[model samples]
Target: MISAASEVFSHAGKHSQDEIALILQKHLKVDSAGHLSNERRISPTRNQWKYETFSPVWGAPEGLNSKFAPPIDDLKSIRGVRGIPHQSLRSVAQWINSKIIPRCHMEWIVSSGALWIVQLDLEWEETDQGKDPADATMVAEGLRPISTASKIFKAFTPGDRTSWPKLKNLEDFDFGTTRSGPRLYFATAEQLQQALATSGPLLETEIDELTAGRAVLRTDLDRTDSGILNLPRTDTVDGRLAVAWLRDTLPLLSERFGSLSGLAVILHAFLPARAAAWAYFDPGTPIAYVDALWGLPDGLQVLPHDSFQVDIRRGRVISQKIRFKPRFLCEAPDGTWRYTEVLRLKGRSQVLSHEEAIEIGLRTASIAEKLGQDAQIMWFVGIPNAYGVDANLPWYRAREKAQQAPRSARRYRPVPVSKQDDLATLPQGDVMIRLDPEAPLIRDDAFLDEVIRIAQARKLPVELQGSLLSHTYYRLSNGGVPVVLAEPYSKYFRTRGRRVFGKLVRDRVPVGIKAGGEHVSEARLASDDALPGLFAKLVEEGQELLQSSDKDSQVEELSDLLEVVRGLAFQAGAEWEKVNQAADRKRETRGGFQERRVLLETSLPKPQADAQLDPREIKLHEFLRVEETGSFASVPIAALVSKQGYASANFELDGQPLVLTLRLSGSRIELRLEEEPSDETNQGDLFSAA
Candidate 1:
């Protein structure tokens, strides 16, 4: 499996995705596949050791202890999880490391094949390579000693903050002068304190042109005048999104818990992973890593680069990456402060084997000591630990169990490229659905037609998401688990393909549109019964209509769009008339979209060609929910922005015809293609003319 994956990846680096994928399919075979548990995964860290009885041992290939393999399935039964019985040793390690649950359910992605007793380390400082268990510490002093062990790890570089261009106030923020859509503002310390004193603390909005269509993240969160709410590092889009979360979360939390500690606890309860991400900046480290740092705090500061060395298990830590320090310094109830190494434990593991994480944490503490900081070491977990520390605390501030919203795990079905180069277009909801006269695939959508009927009756648009845009996959089901065989997909293949079809099958003539992305999963569309997904589908369909030049289709699509709008309004707890009146009031200021207007200028990033991006256009933090994913990390920023429902309007700039395309991938005005550089007359300048 590794060889096949390696070959496919290597080929993918140089060739068009479709061609490379074809080459891979000719040579490769499927092993296993399913949803990744990485959404909530955390890199293991240090402090003290907590032990539990180990579960019954499971067998796997050499050097990989079955006790510490990659995780298995999270869903009850994924569709087609198994292709072959065993995978690579690497997969096994990842499975164990991820701490996937219900060991009895270990039934997918046999990531490794090599067989041997996995050796483990007792404890030792560390090395650039694997740790030998014999040289490591004694496990409680009674356990069997490990002779040897092998490890595989991954690392990442911290985002560069240089392009997070400093803007002192909201007034200076303008992603695009003409395209700036929604924005949020920060609350002053005085305003926050004042709000806190009121019966119901309320975060207010400044009400400016930027507030046009954006929702306010009004929260009741408050702190003293001297205390600052340490915001997570975010570019424009992510900052707005963070505010959106605060708007929704703060109010509910305000009514639930009366104390700051309660807020901290519930914050962890509601969104544990996000809360963890926030902890890096939170001066108090309130909810996450509670008790890791205790005391009258000095302030929060990030450690300079080159402070810690990276080893194999440490993954690939970039030398310049900033590491926040004083991570352990905190004041206890007695008002005295302490610095401690914090060991993080996963809640899912009944028997925790995180000696490596602990070692790393201790190593980090020692590094801090060398820096001349007086700090100690401790341990923390997703929940209170085996030692019962903070167990009695009001961590769960909810009056009753909060039914966390089901995570959005959208199901995908393969959609084939109907015509490899379909030029014939037919009207479908304003956007022309293209097909080829001499294509290999046959069209049959009786099943889909019925599905659409039911969807329209329910006032929902059929959702459509492109497949892994950069790679194409052949998916099949085995024992209710989804299995995938993937190869490269070209940038052209992704953009040209549209719509979707039923699942893939052997010798199938063809399917629907060729949706592409870096993901290996099939393109996804909500079933008839899926309402939430339909809302987005409707909005997408509406965008397609707006993109169309067909007047009749545009009118019809507009009606369909209005209907979707009404459905959205109902879902958002607003009446149709109220929405209509609000629209009317807005039109009184910014005129409605009557003429097909072309936006010519913006302060947002404009890339001449796909590359590192003019720093102005590069956003380090997520702006849209889509940016939150690493799936399209390598996809060109243009493609990402193109997904935003904006039309590539052609206009004249400085006496030259130029295309001013809106970068819609981010939630708001993010980037633009200043000029189509492909033209014969000049080099494409993203913003300025030749």
Candidate 2:
């Protein structure tokens, strides 16, 4: 019996050894002692032991095919095999009756040498007196009205027990057990519809009605008269029975069919022959599906070849094809069959971080910086004008016109132009000049020159002049004219005269014209209304000098007249004439004699005794000596005056000395030589000549 049980265990490909042992112990009564015991008494010790008996003779060739003995009645009734020993055949019979026949198990049917098992479990549900008429109608409709038998039969194949044949009721149905694993109960379409409707509200109510009163029976038991022996039904009496039956029966079937065990349940239905049988079982539930398929009892294994193949493009599964490896299939959260790996692909994920965005911003900033001064202004709709006419032009023109008016009429002068006309007349250009209210009047010559140059380049007319000298006007070739007034000429002449005269006297040079108060007074007298008498006196004096006969006296008077003319020219900012050349020449030609050149004869104040003694000259003298080598010489002196009364230096040297210094002041010198002196005597002779 144990040997037959081992064969059965080996044939049940999916059940673990422990699970098979439990099943055998529960149903076949094959104990660990390798003996078959009846439920009420022990059998006599039967020595049916043979080495070949323990071997799988039902699948082996010689033992069952041997001609030594005819097949025993028990063995024939169990599987119809001719075997060698009666005891051995009886053992096989007990194994078949307890573990194979009643449960519908078979092994090694030999059309060929390949071994295969055909197993089936049948379950019958006894209808109650109050069984819903709706359930009866559902049963009559067929086990799987929506699916073809061939399509539905695959669900009940061995190695899968998580699904089962759904039944509406159990009346006049065979409740026979064979050498199969366990009976499976499945919900009918009506029961499943009710369960689905009760479980989910959003699904259409019609879906609920299609599955009500449907369930599959997973275990075999006698139908007692008492109603307490109730069969499992779908949760909802009206919901779609197919999915609900699958959901409820699959859990129990998977639990009973140990991991990988294979079994099949076939249901009898009133439909046509092609639709009478419905198979139900789960495919092998992966470890992950244990909780979800826990209570299922009739689930058939869905082979890898039976799974649907999906074409994945990009991230989505598009079309399905049969004959691919069975991906773990389970009910999704939405109660639909879904591939677990595909669901994982649909999950949401993030690809960028905040820091990455910040880095992009920094890169943009860097790019903008590299573009440098070439940035262009972006324009938008309806912006106010940035460059407008100078607001101060009206006031400026009014003041200017007022100043131009005669003094008496100026007080009543009106605005030079209306504000609108003033704005309309403003010049337009690419460059805008903003005038500073506190800017000083245009006084710098260079600045004025640039302004004039720019205006000329742009063909804008303008002019330049000192406001105190004279009025100058400029006209553009096109027609615009501007006027500029110089500084007062008289004031410039007086100021220049005072400055030049002061410098000349302070340096002790000869003053050709005086600029003291008396000279100024004389000038004032010449122009003042109160100085007419003085002018007349000066005219009388001039006439007397003109009439004098003594040559010396005449010369003196002529000199005074020459001085007055020079003073006049100097005050007027004109070059002074040493003598009135016109007057002197006239006198010489009229007198028939040449005038003597007095500048050569007159002493020029000894040429300023210390004029050549400049501090820079002394420094030069020291530098030359410091840089001089052997025999190079530097001579220090108090003064060096030129023959023309302009003082500098006279340097004398001999040989190619590095340097020679001629002192012109206590701190000044003049260098003359470049190279070292060969002899001191030669340098001395050069100094003596200087």
Candidate 3:
């Protein structure tokens, strides 16, 4: 009924809240006193009525009961009874606001063919979640539900201290052998200080908006014996200790990050045992690179971990490599965790399966998609479950650091290709196997098996056209001949082939002159007189790198360009240290180009000119004079030579040795040929005199 009212009067000022309530009351058969009228009842023949019926059928005479049944007024009244729908939620919310009860979890029921308010509780009843933070009191008085971890936190914190709000729920608060991980909470500086009154061995790390999360801290409070000692304990690491660490570390971090306002103090309940994973994602690509280790991710700073590449778009594991496993972190018998040598498993046993890695990649990709930026995610693979500890939007470092130069063409482990004769015996149809062409494909039985499974599930012929990114599709013909069809193969082949050749050329230059430092060096470039020319070449390469669409070419070109810049810096008698300092000063004031902001045109008031001038009357300086005979510059070449720091230079004019000398004539310098009597000069000494 409220939906009907909204649809009837959607425009602003067309109807007031009172008008809507009155309309609802009339339709729902409510009295002026807000009590439901005694004109509603469940139909006696409700069993015979259609179980599921639309609005139109509900209003019909016989639709409420059996078809042959006589019509009843109360039956029709049921159709007018009101309840919340998508469109009516807004109207109901407005009505709820006017109620004397400020906060409630309400229930509405259709009774005697009229809608009736059956229940109204002052607090959320859990039948369904009410509004987030149902009332202001929830925030002002800390009335919100406290998870087990948070309750433990409150016990340690002072009663008069600030309340540490729970950022998220601790999925499991009991420290059990099967526990996956701890719950995370957030606190302010005051709350953290209160919790830090009692502290012990704790792990500390700094965090800001741009950081990629930190390791979970393990403290004495997280010990299993704490529960027996009647002390507050958490299944995960003690949040109090984590908060204390943040309080002490925050000031130090502020020096580097420049501010504490943006810092979010997070406390994680420590989950013991098992392994951890971290993933890096780029918005431009459909892939996420993941690294996993046998121990806590805290060791990621120093230890080598297993790497896997996942195709986020298709949730497929594109490539994976298992590295040597020397040790892993696990729960010690004393309820603390430490690293131990990998005695149980020899070689590199996979920390996470292909499925687990793909799931992490997909989740990371979803976060990046929603945020519209790149992201890094960290997770813990614990007993029977994987916990996502943190997600972060990594700081933008495109201009802050130089990209690693592309070294060599990517080498892929060759996969067995089907021969034409083998293809001729296969089914004939179309099958799509989402694959990354550049990904290593050797010994991946899962990939090939999956393809075959998909084909068999689709019941396609043996000869089928397998499709993927820029690939050659094949199908068997009736005559047992294999027919091949490439969908835009040339496009990818030409581009990739050209990039390989380009990289070879780009790599060759830097490697050849890199040795002996003689071919290109500060000393060589100092007197070589080609610094400006090399600088110009750097500028050209920079422009090409920026404008080109090929990513491989850009990397190669940028590396070569940076080499030239280093040489130019050396020739200028300035080390990279000075250059970096100057760059920092300029960047601090002028800013970098990462914003991609373009200045189209500025709107400013036109300046008032004192006078106007005409081009015809203005006398221009005669830099050069030409009367269809020859040209003569007002400035002497000898002056230019001296200004250019050259005393004398040898040049070839019309294939003749011309030695030009810089001589002082009055206040100006003039260029004069060395006194040489030769008739080959055409005009002899006259030419030299002129």
Candidate 4:
């Protein structure tokens, strides 16, 4: 619905939220007799339904029950039946905004049934998301729903922390053999002090009685063991995301953090997936409204469940039910509704820990394995949008410090569109932009990283094709075969081919080409140098590498050797199977070098005539300084000198016997054959005695 709306509005030129609201009303709401009136829905361009079968549970009056019943006569009388689709509406509005709005100067939120545009052209503000919505001007004026105008239902904002969804049933967790990992948390000093100040005396005393660093966390539920003892986990999502977004970041932070003064206090919290699902979605009378409001990614929905079963022995959960179950039931890989867990950590001191995160990752991986799908971490509908790195903030600065080079670090120049032909002319490889032209995303970075990772893993040669500033294109190829940049092949390196997406995500950042964006991942590189010679050199190096004690080193080097040989063979017009067959035939007849036998010397009778000499031998010796001192079967002295330059002869120096190698010092002076070529390694045997 949002996509079709965006296409329609964008094509029509400049539009206002008010205009969108009208169009939405026509499309979203049914007519008096429950019929769609939106023309766009039926248009060939969209071809989508504007309305769905009305449900009786929406408290439809008797007059509106039957299919033939008169269209809703009084839109006002049914006004009281409407309420919270809060998050879903926000999600849809955000989607439309992303797809249509180019300028981010204004922020729009759906409230009081009207699109409230908040001007944010100036600077970032300290947003209090939990503030009461009744204070908003639009809500007080009774904007859209008749109930709000008549003061029947209080308008609530989607993320109002106070209005979080309630899960009533609590089941005991049977953590058979599973022990809960460390309970991670995050909070700033101010938030911690505020919580303490608001705590009741008994609860306060309980917290006070705990050891110096411990605290009692109690839920507002009528159950035993609700107050679990936990130490203040002084970690923040800002800290986690800032200091450990990538695996390499932790190593950089662990030992060599240079200056602390540059640190900007980061303000952000992480609610683990289990807890966040509820805050991002609301289950209301009208179910479709939830989808539009949350704009959740496809193949997923939210539900909540118990983290533990009824049996808890000591501290170890001994049963399969010991795992944390979110109250929100999301659609798993197998199309089953399963409880998905999430946690939220906020502020400076309290944050989710690295170990707990690993635990969560493992749990999800196990779930994915059971479902016969790639292991993935599922997220709540709109949660991804809520968390983002603001470069103008301290976290961004920390990010720069953590990285070996900042994201903006220059690597190569961008090939202009005029150089579109240049992409085709690249030495040898496909052309793909390093990343999107706009903001660079971690997921994209991960995607490219995976490219390199797979190539290295497979020992395939990969070249960073070229770059447009920070955006670098990559080409992964082997035997002149480029990667297909699609599924089966595209997902070769990813642990999970799927992704955890944000509400507005289109299949989660769409992992393929953009329209009109030309992409190539393989190329048969052209070179002026002798590729066969290079291949030979690489083979030698690889053989040397094989001499190493480490089998892994040999394997990697051999992979490199194979890549070079493939290119060389292809360039030289050689077939792999034929080469292999030739090798097998030779090995069978002449035998291989399996036995460590040393060839101390090899000898053959010298040929007495040129006719007895092999052409291969002459070609081999053609590279030497020749002094034809002895008569070559009665050749003229002048002619022999002119042709041979110099010749060699056997002689005795003192008691030692030796052949006076063709030394042109005194006999004759001439240049050596410098451009001769030979692939065969032995020519001395070829020349001697035929």
Ranking the candidates on lDDT from highest down gives 3, 1, 4, 2
Q: What is the C-alpha lDDT of each candidate?
A: 0.28, 0.27, 0.39, 0.27
State which candidate, 2 or 3, has the greater TM-score: 3
Off by over 4 Å in 2: 1-138, 142-204, 210-690
RMSD of each: 35.1, 54.9, 31.2, 30.4
Alpha-carbon TM-score of each model against the true structure = 0.17, 0.13, 0.27, 0.19
- Highest TM-score model number: 3
Candidate 4's residue-wise lDDT over 1-690, tens digit each?
878877877865664554443233332332212122112112111111122212221211111111122333222322322233223323333343334422123233323344333323321223322212112111111111111121111222222233111111101111122322112122222333333346434322322222111221211112223221111122212212222222233233233334221111111122212121110101211000010111111111111111211111122222111111112223333322233323211111111122232233333333334444332222222122222221011000000111111111121222222122332343322232222111112113334455445434443332221110112221122223232211111222222122232211112223442232222233233465546455545645544453557888888777766766665676677898887898899999988987533333446757773432222323323443333443322222232222333344444446554443221222232222212321233223322322
Model 3, position 271, has a per-residue lDDT of 44
Quote the lDDT for 480 in model 2: 30
Better of 3 and 4 by lDDT: 3
**Where in model 3 is the C-alpha error above 4 Å?**
1-182, 194-265, 334-337, 383-690
Q: Measured by TM-score, how close is model 4 to the native structure? A: 0.19
Model 2 per-residue lDDT tens digits across residues 1-690: 878877887887565555544343223221111122111011111121121221221111111211233343442333322333334434443444444322121222211222112233321122212222111121124223232223122233233434322221221121125212112223233333344557544232323222222322232222222221112322212234434455666456446434213333333121111000011111221000000010011111111111111111122212211211212222233333333221111111111122222222232222224433111110011111221111100000000111231111111111121123332343555222111111111222233344434544653333222111111111111123232111112333222223232111111223322321112212233333323433333343455464678999888877755554454555455665544565578777765334321121334566656543322222222222232334542332211221111122233456432444342221233344535443533543454565
Give the per-residue Cα lDDT of candidate 3 at 464. 20
How far off is model 2, as Cα RMSD? 54.9
Per-residue lDDT tens digits of candidate 1, residues 433-489? 111111111111332233333333433222211111100000101011221212112
